[model samples]
Target chain A: MMNCQGCRDDLVAYLDEELEQSMQAQVEDHLERCVSCRQEHDSLRQSYEFTETYLSSLEPSPYLWTRISAGLRGEPMPVRAPWSWLAARISNSAVAVRLAAVAILVLGVGSSWLFYHERKLTGQARQEMVQFVADWEGLDVSRVNPFLARHEHPVDELEANPFIDLHHHDIKNPFRHEER
Target chain B: MKRPKTEARAEDERIGELQEWLQRSKQQDLEAFHQLYQRYSKRILNYIYRMTGSVADAEDLTQETFVSAFQNLKKLKDDGKFESWLFTIARNNVYQQFRKKQIPVGSLDAGGEEERSEYERIAAPVRDPQEEALYSELQHVVNEVIEELPEKYREVFVLSAIQHYDYKRISEIVGRSLASVKTDIHRARLRVRDRVKRYLGQSS
Candidate 1:
C-alpha cells in the first residue's frame, strides 16, 4: 500500500538492503506494480554499478614507504629542498621554544625601559612646575601692594590732586572746543 | 555479492595476522609496523587521493597518517579495528590539511590541470584504444561530479562506493552517526547518477 512518493523515498535504503523484511516486501510489491518506481530503482542500481566499474584504486609512489620510514625514525626526508629543510629545522620544537623565549625577553626589557623613561619624564615635569610655583610664592608682596592700591582710588580724589592738571590739560573737556 | 567461504576465511586469517602485527608494533618492533604499512598504505593513499583529488597531496597526507599512526600505536585500544582507525587518521589528516590551507570544500580548482594530467599519466595503461578513450572520458566526468559534491557527502560516498566500506564502518571512520552516513551516501549516489545519466544522454 506504499504510495509512489513513499516508495521513492525508501528506494535508496531498499537498494542498500537496510530496510526491514516487511518494508522490503512492501517496496517489492510496489515495484512489481509500479513501472515508474521500478525504473527509478534500476537507474539507481545502474549508477552504483557504473561507479564501481569506473572508479578504481590508484597506485602510490614507490618511494612513499621510504619517506614514511624516515619520518618515523626522526630522520630528515632526503628529497626536501634546502629552504624546506631549513624551514623544518626552524620549526623544530626546541628551536621554536628558544625563539619564543628570546622574543619574550626582548619585549620585557623594552617595556621596562619605556616604563622607566616615561616615569622619569613625568617626575622632571612635576618638579619644574613645583619650582615655578615656589618662586612665585617667595616674591615680595609689599612692593606690589602700593602699586595695586594707587589704581584703587576714586576718580574724584584723583581730580583734586595738584599734580593732576584736569582743567589745563582739558582732561574732562578734551572733546569741547574753546575760543581762548 | 556474497563472498565464497574460502575467501571469507582468508580475510579472517589476514585480520588475525594484522592483529599480531599490531601487538608487536606496540612493542616498538619496526619490522612489524612496516608490515602493517605495506598492507594498508595503498588503500589509505587512494582514500586520501580521492578525498583531495591530488596525488601529490595524497602522498604527503598518507605519509603523515602512517607516521602519526606509528607514534600513537600504543594508544590504540582495539587492534581489530585498525582499518577503521587508520582510515580515521587519514580522514583527520586530509581535514587538517584543508583547514591549514583554507581550501574550500568541493573546489573545482582543487584538481588542477597539472594534477589531472599526472593522474591520467599514472592511471593510463595499454588497452584497446576505443574503450580507453571512452573510459577516460567517463572517468573525467565522474571525477568532476565527485569533486563537485560537498565535502561531507563526498567523503561518505567515496568510502561507501569506492572503498567498499559498509555503513557501520564508514560511520566509525568518519565519526558520524550511521543514519547520517546512510543519508549522505544515498544523496551522493543520486547526484552522481543524475550527472552521469545526463552526460550519457548527451553523448549518445
Candidate 2:
C-alpha cells in the first residue's frame, strides 16, 4: 500500500531495521515492486557501509598516547600558559582550606568595621548640616548686625568646615576593595 | 543498530570497568588513566579524524582532550558520565579549532529544520544511483563528504555511524534530544548519499 515517496522517506530507517514490524512489512512490499525506491535504498546502504568501513580503518598514532601521557605529567601544559596550573595546584592543596577560612574572617571583620565607621560619619555629617543650615539662615554676611557676632555663622567657627560632609561618606569609597 | 543481548552485557561490563578505572585515576594513578587512554584514544582519534579530516590535527586534538580530561577530572561530578563528559571536551576542542579558522561552528542543540534543510541542499546535489556506486569504494571521497557535512549533522553522523555510539549516548554528548540525534543521523546518511552521487557526476 505504500508509495515510492513513503518508502524513500523510510529508506534510511528501513536499512537500519528501525521501522516497526507493520511499517517494515509495508516498506518491503513497496521495495519488492518499486524498482526505483529499491535502488534508493541500495544507494543509502552503500554509503552507510562505505563510511563505516573506511572510518573504522583509522588508527591513532602511538605517539599520541605518549603526548597525552606526557601532558598528564605536566610537560609544559598546552592551551594556555604554564602558569594555568597554578590555579589547579592551589585549589588542590590543603592550604586552600585554611586560606578560604582566613578570607572569610577578613571579609566579615572588614565589612563590620566599614559599617561602624559609616555610621559615625553619618552622625557627624548630620550634626554639621544642621548647624550649617541654622547659622546660614540666622546670619546674613552682608548685614552688620549684633546677631551675626553671636551666631558667628557656625561655618566660620568650624575649623576648615569647607564643604560640610553633605554626602555623609562613612568611608570615602568604601567599595574600594584594595584600600580595605 | 540494535546490539545483541551478549554485546549489551559486554558493554555494561566495560562501563563498569571504566568507572573503576576512573575512580583509581582520581587518586593520581597514572596506570589507571593509561588503561582508559588505551581503551578510548583510538576511537576518539577516529571520531576526530572524520570530523576534521586531518590525521595530524586529530592526533593532536585527541591528546589535548585526554590531557584536559585528566586536569579537570575533579570537576566531573559523576563517574558514570565520564565518556559523555570526555566527548563534550573533545567536541569543544574541535569547535575551538573551527573558531581559530573563523568559521561559525554550529551547535547540535541549535539545529533547526530549516537550517538543516538549507545545509543539506548545499552539501548534497542530486544525481543518479549508478553514479554513487562508482565512488562508494573511494575512501578519499567518502572522507571528503563526511567533512563537508555541517558540524551539527557531522557530530551525530560521526558518532552514530563511524563510532557506533547509540542514540542515547550521542544525545548526551551532543546535548540534543534522542529524537533529534536520530533524525540528524538519518538525514546525514541521505545527504551523504547525494553528495557522493554528485561527486561521481562531477568526476565522470
TM-scores for the candidates: 0.69, 0.58
lDDT values for all models: 0.77, 0.69
Give the worst 10-residue stretch by lDDT in candidate 2 chain A. A141-150
Interface RMSD of 2: 12.6
Using alpha carbons, what is the TM-score of model 1?
0.69
> lDDT tens digits, residues B84-184, model 1?
99999999898888888897754534334445555466867777989888887777777777878888889988887778788899999998898898889
Per-residue lDDT tens digits of candidate 1, residues A1-180?
899988988887788777889999999999999999999999999988887777655776667788888877789965532343333434445665787898899999999998786566545554544343333335333322221121234557867898986555735331122335
Among incorrect, acceptable, medium and high, the docking class of model 2 is incorrect
In the range A1-180, model 2's lDDT, one tens digit per residue, is: 898888887777777666789999999999999889888888888777766654424555455666677778878644432442343334343655777888899999999998776565545554554444445445332332222222334445454565666345366431122322
DockQ, candidate 2, vs. native dimer: 0.15
- Among all candidates shown, the one with the greatest lDDT: 1
TM-score of 2: 0.58
Query: Residue B108's C-alpha lDDT in candidate 1?
Result: 38
What DockQ, between 0 and 1, does each candidate earn? 0.18, 0.15
